[model samples]
Target chain A: MRGGSWRQSSLTGIGVLFGVTLAGLLLLPFFALAISTPASDLLEGATHPLFASALLLSLRTTLTSLSITVVLGTPLAWWLASSSSKTARVIEVLVGLPIVIPPAVVGVALLQTFGREGLLGPALGSVGIALPFTEISVVLAQIVVSAPFFVKAGASAFREVRPDMLIVARTLGASPPVAFFRVALPIALPGLLVGASLAWARALGEFGATLLFAGNMPGRTQTMPLAIFYALESDVRLAIVFSLVLAAVGMLLLVALRFLPALRNFMRGGNA
Target chain B: MTSWQVIVRARRGELDLDVTFEGDEQPIALVGPNGSGKTSVLRAIAGVLDLRDARITVGDTVLEDTSAGVRVPIEERRIGYVPQGFGLFPHLTVLENVEFGLSTGKNPLQSEERSRRALQMLSELNCASLSERSVKHLSGGEKQRIALARSLVLEPAFLLLDEPLAALDATLRRTLRQFLAERLRLFQGPSITVTHDVRDVAALGAQIVALENGRIVQQGPLSLIQQSPATEFLAEFVGAD
Candidate 1:
């Protein structure tokens, strides 16, 4: 009995040790950041004009990127879900490639493809269109880098939809478009929203690609992350403030997403 | 009076289905074993399944005739189908699911009127208490009732149910079979039910069309199919003792 108790105690000790180490690795940096930065200084730095502009720019660009992602991604996702052709698989793999590629490389590749001297550059230049180092370029960069997230989530959600539901709708006198919008879209909304939120967060925090493609310009193209980088070069307090604000917004979005009835149903393991 | 005759031919992998049937006053039950093309027959009649050579006519309407190169879209077929799983829209409330077909159709009923109609349908199915409840919250039996109400509220020319009680427990299946028989009797239109359960044929009091290997082996009154059972497969299907 004593030996069994000793072994049990040792097992308990091992469990606690593993749990603590895992928790520390996962949470230590966040705790350190919270501890290191004083709330008062963070607030003061956040109110600075340049930081304010960056925050606004980040919100605007990320929202625009999100809108574009939803519009284009939803149909593509739906198509991918319904089609079993080899071409659809190829397109799915192509869309997923962005997620695995390093963000910095994605940035460089975007520049090489859409830059002034790149492919389609001559045609675009002839039309007097310039993409690099502009605010629009920032939006474009965010879209290209963030859209795959929305597409992937939206496709999975669409795939989860029962084909019989759509067939029932059609037999009940619903046109294809009406059935898709009324039945499929509502069912897939939670996943689509989650995808949008993820893409928005990624776009909001975008630094490497934005810097490479859009070029950090204050009040023009400088997003919150870019501002944080610039502020850290001069004022550390402002960087902390920007980081806090971004974190707060992200948290708020997550809370809002959780409140959606569709998402809530999904979380509770209810099928759509 | 809406009357229909349908002939469909299709090859799904190794299974080739070539079948023909007609309907008038009687409610038909396509009784068959698994993969015997019962659901495919209903799907073809509903215009949900694409067939290489198919001809379908409902009253004066020529819905589909591949030989004549005419095929009606599913939305235009004016047929109601309840798939095997009941396929309730989990995101919508019971009332909303019933109202869906009416709201999106060519000649859409007004929302208020549609709600009233839906409520009446729920009442018919003894599920009026579940109107405001989300479909996801409904029990399996309640969901099936709502799916039936949703399909029936449209008052289509014909109705199709694929394995209507296949998802229910034995007790629920018996209860629902009785309820469905009563409802089908009052429908005032041709109806087709696909099921493997011989008990459903008796309970629903439907004409039995037994199928084996995608071909109609025998079809007549339920008693005839049960008593004679043209093929050995039909005898096995009827669970001959």
Candidate 2:
């Protein structure tokens, strides 16, 4: 069992070669981004007003969208996880539609719902509120595009919590809400954290929806992705810096997701 | 002694459960083959499982009556349940799990009272040393004791235990069976225990309620059931002709 025949070993060697090739090809650009850029160019781009504004806007919008998603999605996830109704199944599919649909399509849908002269045009106008081409629109676009990740992950996580646990909690004199908060939520927190990080990353890189719905306005709705789009046409080095920054944030989230389970186990003094 | 009457009609998956039984202060042992709806009956009495129709009454108080549209919520039912596999809260310390019911019911105790009561319950179970440990770290028997203590701390009017010793090894199961039998003897209120072991019924000296495919085939003392086992499962359980 320790060693295979020569032919079997050669087959495994070939499989390894194929896997390494694909991985190297996928990672080549990141290495290029890190090594090919000049230090002076990176520093200059980092200090630029456009870079700073775009970075700030991306952070602010993604955080806002992430918080909103968690607040709204937790209860929805719990309900969907607990209910065995056909309506819940339908709603689950509808909630997950945004993840599969293109971001540009999502932008169009948001415009149709919130834009002036759209479906809710008169209602919004009566209230003196216009959502299109605003910072709020940027947040809306991010939420529309990113919320599905959180909801999907959260529902699955809540499902993993044993139904018997909730029943016992309720029978132990905790109300339904108390059972969820004390029993289900803590058990599902790790998965929810991963979902939130993914949602934040998706919101941070929102380009199509923000561009079409919020418009690429400097110091307002021009997020890092949009900045990169414009930066690419004028200065490639500036675009590389923006790409590096976005990639770095994404890498950090991936790294966190990788270690989160181990961290949770350590916090729990290792699983029994 | 106050009498408890439980009548439940519910359908879950393939099980069409419609059973009725009444008992005084003595514990009732609910035994059946796999998938015979014993756990569902306990869940129904506890008001955790929604029933098509039910009339659950303990002495003078009605816990559930579908015809009257009076169904007490699970938290207000004053029923303690120990589900199969113990169902301990994985995130809380053992003491915190015990304190949960006392700290957040209809009439919550103050912080000090809650801690004292939880500690007292743990000590009574001989698990005071496990107070600060996470529930995830306890052994199967320890988890069972902590789970029982957690429920008992609420001072429930009724208790429902579902296969409390099913997860333990044979030796541990035997030990906990004796421990549980003693505890049940001391408990003052009506309780139902779901089990497959005939030894459990004989040890607890409980009224027997044998279910088969969601229907109660026998309900009486174990001696009567021993005279004529109703189903093949029960015959195998009691090893009788």
Candidate 3:
């Protein structure tokens, strides 16, 4: 019995060591960044007007992109969840390709689709609509890269919902939209929010695609991440400040996500 | 009075199902072993499954008749279905789960009254105290009651319950079966309950339709079917040991 207890203790010790090491590797950078920066520097960074404007523009674009993603991706996700058709699977794979392809390749693809000399350009021009090198272009770029995240997450979330629940709702006399909003959406909300947050964060920090397609025009197209790039060239302190602001906002969202009721209930359910 | 004559044919994997049944103002229990196409019969009636040749009639209404090419959407069918596994909306509270079927009306009180009626049904089942709890938090027995309340609140012309107690524990199963029988007695309209348990037939005293593989092998009063089971499978299924 003593030997068995010793074996169990040693096994537990090894497991704890492995878990701690993995956590340390993942969290070390953020801790180091925070510890190395003086509180005074962080405070100074927080007060800059340029930082504020970049922050505002980042927020605006991220929100707009997130809205557009939810609007377009939700119905598509629902369809993908409910459909057993081979064609729907093909469409699902096509939507997922954006996430798999490198961001730089996505930039190139977007330019090819919407750039001045590209496909749909002449038609848009005929309608007097220009897409590249503007705030709208920044939103478009973010949507191109980030929308897939929402779609993928939303689809999986919807798929996790049992068809029986939806059937019960319909039998109870709920229309398709009513059943979706009441039953499917609420059940899928936690995942949808997590996906939205991840996509929003990705869009806010997007650099390669924005630089390639939207161009780095300050006050018009330059978001915080782009501003950080330019500020690093001109002033290192300003870049650090921008980075600090971005980190703070990201942390705030992560913290706020915990407060979501659906997530709370989901966690309380313990793997239900 | 509502009446139904349903015939559907569907092939799924190794199972080929061709079933025909007629009922009016009586509860029919489809009792069979696992994978005997009992649930498939219910699904076909609910219009959740497409059949090559299906002819379903509720009263004078022709819900589906593939011979004449008429298929009504599930939403407009006026049939309440409680699928196996409770199928409670995990995100909604018990009251909300029960209220879901009633919330579609233009008058809010129509929904409120329906919800109240649902609560009363839950109370009758001794689950009213769990009204504020999320369906996900409810015990399996509680979820079953909520699923039943949700279905019955619609006041549908035809009710279908597919293995309603299959997900519960053995202890809960026996108790809920009794409660279910009592509830079914109160429902004046036609209902079809599918189950694998022979005890359900004895407890409910329902008209038994015994199925094997994908066909109805024997069907009649529970006493008649119990005493003289037609097939060897039926003899084994009715617990003739």
RMSD of each: 2.8, 2.5, 3.7
lDDT per residue (tens digit) for residues B1-241 in model 1: 6688988898866679999888785789898778888888888888877798999888888989999999999998888899988999877888989998888766899989999999999998999988888787687788889989998998888889888888888889888889888888889788999887777788777888877788998998877866888988788878642
B92, model 2: CA deviation in Å?
A: 1.2
Q: Which ten residues in a row have the lowest lDDT in candidate 3 chain A?
A: A263-272
Tens digit per residue, CA lDDT, model 3, A1-272: 99999999999999999999999998887776667667787676667666777888898998999999999988898898889999999999999887888878878888888887889888888899898888898999999889888888889989889988887777666777887888899889888887888888889888888888888888888899999998888876778878767888889888877777655766655333
Q: If scored against the real structure, what TM-score would every candidate get? A: 0.93, 0.93, 0.88
Report the number of the highest-DockQ candidate. 2
The Cα RMSD of model 1 versus the native structure comes to 2.8
TM-score of candidate 2 against the unseen true structure: 0.93
Question: DockQ of every model listed?
Answer: 0.61, 0.69, 0.52
Worst-scoring 10-residue span by lDDT in model 2 chain B:
B232-241
Native-referenced TM-scores of chain A, all candidate models:
0.90, 0.93, 0.85
Docking level for model 1: medium
Candidate 3 chain B minimal-lDDT segment of 10 residues: B103-112
Off by over 4 Å in 1: A1-5, A38-40, A258-272
Let me know the TM-score candidate 3 reaches against the reference structure.
0.88
- Candidate 2: residue B36 lDDT (0-100): 92
